[model samples]
Target: MEMKNNTVEVNHIRKAYGNRAVVNDLSFVVKPGEIFGLIGPNGAGKTTTIRMMMDIIKPDSGEVKILGETLTEGAKNNIGYLPEERGLYKKLSVIDSIIYFASLKGVDAKTAGKRAEELLKRVDMIGHRQKKIEELSRGMGQIIQVIVTIIHSPQLIILDEPTASLDPVNAQLLKEIMLDLRKQGKTVIMSTHRMNEIEEMCDRILMINKGRLVLYGDIPSIKAKYRNNSVLIEFQGELGEIPGVTEKRPHDHAVELMLDNKTTPQMVLETLVHKRINVNRFELSTPSLNEIFIKVAGDERE
Candidate 1:
């Protein structure tokens, strides 16, 4: 298929079961050649939103646009999806299963076989191409599923926890693959609980909480949006009686001080100098995605 600027536009999609709403008026845009992440704690409607985008499940209300059109059977063929749940047939050989899935996406046998060989080599699973699905480890099986998902070279890829069962090494390999896909101008939408992955891999993120959009923007902007303007200061000598220090969290090597209103970092530095404490590194602490997740998701997990 000839590639275009394959963007995903979700405009107020809603899915509910009876009186409960699993996804409520969620909207976001994923641009082409970008790695966009849909992230939230479990049961926060991440899966429902992804399913609706893929047309796997019809939304109770609202629409999903993929590649500039309403999602349909043809649109689906342009997507490579790896769901969180494993779906490989244990009875089939790994290469056979991969080819089968590629064929479903309209790839011919010859092209599928060639691409499967290359992908297996890329994933360092070339030797196990003929192995049965049941013989491979859980991590290996996950890798095979990922290969199957992208065999057809779809313009848009959707991965749900793509590294669920893999070790750190394999997980890193998957991250590299995702980056390669983006370099090839493919739009990727990945859902993962790994905040580190989202931080390192995604260009933009959409955070959903209680089935509603809590945050959506570029990573730096999102982090900046939640920044508390707190700074961490490490001092050797006793620097007691600081006026601006509202609260202090003592770590083994440093202390993170929450400043009081109208207090400046320069003031803290001057106080440390006046106290004659051996000051070490001083830097602002930006909120991580994990912290942002907690702050936005609230105590719902409890």
Candidate 2:
């Protein structure tokens, strides 16, 4: 199947087993060169939804379009997927394992070999190319898995917990690779629970809770939608004497204040000046994705 700019379009998909529905009328689109996130708590049907998208399991209802065509045998070659489950031969050498997986995706031996070496180097695993998978650390194995996923240079890349076992430094490296892929015009679908990763890497997000779509949109807009209209202040002097400050929470390097109903930020600044509270900085606080996720997902559980 020939590929199109619309890498993925899931329309009202429903998946059920026995008497229970796992996914209920889920619909979303992943545009070209965009990093889209599918996030939810455990048992939220995230894995099932991704499986349906990859055609590993058929959905009970609705449609999934990949590269503007219904997912099929030929369509698989145009997509790359790193499943949550790790699948690697423990006895196989790093280079051989990557080549083996790449070959399954229709990559030629020579091309796969060359690409494997390049990817290993890119991920800083070239020095261990000849080492057995069993000899490598969990983080090293995860890097190899990522290499295998992108060996064919698929138009759409789907990664499930891509950095789950990686250290902070390696996790940041993988994130950079994802951004580089986007720069090359490849669409990426990232499924992870790390709110910070979604905030920094994803262009848009689809948040599912208990198989239902709870939130979907660009990051900034979503944050703005849930903002509490509060201000954050950093001061050297005492803030307890400020009469207008109704509530305060001490953060690592600053304090977050909840202003009174009638008090404006200007009034708070004036009060600080009058009290000589050596104000260093004052800014409006926006709701973080983590906060929004907890609020939206947690409230539903109640």
Question: Can you tell me which runs of candidate 2 are displaced by over 4 Å?
Answer: 1-4, 234-280
- 156-215 per-residue lDDT for model 1 (tens digits): 899998877789999998999999999998989999899999999999999887799989
TM-score of each: 0.93, 0.87
lDDT of 2 by residue, 73-152 (tens): 87898889999987799999988888888888889889999988888888877899999999998888888888889999
lDDT of 2: 0.89
Residue-pair clashes, model 1: 0
In terms of lDDT, the poorest run of 10 residues in model 2 is 1-10
Model 1 lDDT on a 0 to 1 scale: 0.88
